[model samples]
Target: MAAKTEDLTELSNIISTNVKNYLSHVPTPPTLRPTPPVPVTDEVAAEAREQLLLACRRVISLVGGPIETVMGMSAAFHQTTAMKLAYDMKLAHNVPLDGSPIALGELAAKTGASEETIVRVMRALTLQDVFVETAPGYFAHTSGSAVIGIPGIEALIGHWTDESFASAPHISDALRENNFQPPEDSRKLAFNRAFDTNKNFFEYAYTEDKPMGARFSQAMTAAGTARGPYNLVAVYEPLRAAPKGTTLVDIGGGIGHVAIAAAQKFPNLNCVVQDIGMVVSEGRDGLPEELKDRVEFQENDFFKGQPIGGPGVYYYLRHILHDHPDPWVSLSRPISWEKGDSLGGILSHIASVMDSSSRILIDEDIMNEHMGPEGNKMTITLDFQMLVMCNGKERTEAQWAALLKSADERLVIEKVWRAKRNDSGIIEARLA
Candidate 1:
């Protein structure tokens, strides 16, 4: 036993040392590159390169097994029935939004099941920290579960988990086909089979049963409301400081959350929230009566054309563009483009309205293949979900740059702001 313990200790030390050495050799990301390379003698450069290579190799050897273990655990957790059942139990228990402590018997009664079943589900969820069994049989909601309480959260989760939509179930087929078609094809088939129509997933969700549709809308509103404040503060605060009474247009601003928040944050800043007629109609009653005069909701479709007659400081788009594919010409055909003639075409139109000093802030996930572990995982998962549901794909920085260049010759990516909540990055562009 003593010898085995010593061996394990030595192994652990070796693993730690290798990881440190490996990380030390990682090349600086291109975005972080200096203007010019520092000159070094050939001998010294060669020695440094050799050391870096050796360190990386040693680190890989030490950590490869453990890394694979972590990846497996992640995959299993996402794809397991245990996880799904636990989520369902939590949702049905109504513990998250209820904001009250729940006893096991009460949870079981609420869910219309036996106490044993509820206990088992709670125990499983407890393992994932989705909920806590505070005192053996009583449970409380965890922070993780609160976010999922919003209406659209469960629908989105369900949509992703459906056997026909999940990429995990089709990954093997995708590998064999050497195509991204497996999930794509499955999504198309599922929607067609279920709804007998070719509508986008969100559109389908909107037209579904009362509870589900309401949930979807609520989820979207919740997501926008939760992130809207931060996004506005991150970009608008600086812009607001530059000049007072700057009119800001929020394109496709669902429910006017972004505009409302901005209005509250910058009392001097006039704002317009534009969307389709239905969304604007729904959002009308939610705005404070005082804000009604200042923050107006317009029935405008961006694809048809932007209408605020801007010379505003900035135009903001939050979580909007990822809903469509690139090559805006091809992408615009199937969808409604009433706001502007085309997705790319509208940018030119929006640019025409903007003054020389105006800027565009797009608050969406800017996919970075080399983002840190948590960010990479979440973005990649979202990317696949986009593909399956909307035929949309997340874009890397280069992809975004290309899209902007194609959209309008006058628009240029000035800088990108990374989201604090996750690995997402915001592309900030200026009219050139």
Candidate 2:
């Protein structure tokens, strides 16, 4: 009892300090409304807010007791189910944005869902503060529910709750089938198994379920835009000093926005954005007239040897490597990677094309060795999401080192420009 009391006091202290720090910087108490995630002008305030939120979670877990914690975890799926139903019924749009609440029956009529169903779902959401009960039987939007109004957010929610959620339960079964490999092939994983499809997740998304395909694409865009740490600012210093006339090949870069930005930032350097045929066409067509001369969109697969090669060239891969299984080099001994298997095929191709003066810059989340709730909720969830949907696995710093060394004995991680706020970083590799 004494130890428990001490732990509770420590948690309370943390919460009190962080709350004061946040208020000192912002001078405003947060309300149940949407606002910018971070105070744009104040990094200190942003850090404080993050700390405060983390401390609150810790406090909740500490006080809630083991039974309550486990029960909440077990029933967490109820929230997702409610959210998905709400989304399908277009609940966000149904709710009046003018701070007026709609009665249960009226909301059901508008959304074409049953009043009974709406009542139960709203109850689940309201307890979570997604929506609030303005009166005895009326509902109003809160910050949590209001986010569904954002562009692409609905698709993201739908993708996760529908296809992704369905696949997750079968993960253990897929693991058993694959003998518990850290990462199994996409065809053998939970996604393919759940959907009864022989094609990979991407193929199934695009072909089998067109709506899901569209949702996945939009969700990816939404996610890409949200990762502030992975942007060009993270590694601008090194990129600024590159030779005036060098080629930067963005392998598997989609739609070429990053390549376009790179070309605009560094006028003297040429940029080549490479992807599949459809993506290359879209990127080429979208190129601004000013960057036409410096930026080229080419259709090429990374698994095959790099089509463009030479000295003084830089190969850029953003969020590309984490899509495949890892430890391409066998832990037992040095061995060549199988064709089209893991990062081995991809890395070997890049290694074969690189000259002594060339470099491979991979922009990815460099995960920690251990997944701690205080530090990492996003990356750990993402790692599992990748496992279920595809054969991908996020690599830690040590895992990256072994994989790179296996690709080529000469290849070395020259430097890593880690983001200040997150695991996102630029791993710069060069031939030793």
RMSD of each: 11.1, 4.0
In TM-score terms, candidate 1 sits at 0.69
- lDDT (Cα, tens digit) per residue for candidate 2, span 1-432: 112333767767877887788778775666676443332235676777667667777777778878999999998887888888887889988998655788988998899999999998888888888889988989988777777767677778888889988898898988886578744445668898789987668667766776776577667656766665335544646677878778999887877877877888878789999986666776788899998889998888665558888898889988787876653222221222233433336777888879989998888888888545555677777888888888787788888888888888888898888766666788889999
Best by TM-score: 2
lDDT of 1 by residue, 269-350 (tens): 7778888666777789798988877788888756556665645567888777786655431223434322323343446557
Local error of candidate 2 at residue 84 (angstroms): 1.5
Alpha-carbon deviation at 83 in model 2, angstroms? 1.8
* Model 1 RMSD vs true structure: 11.1
- Model 2 off-target regions past 4 Å? 1-6, 26-29, 34-41, 182-184, 207-210, 285-289, 327-344
Worst 10 residues of 1 by lDDT: 29-38
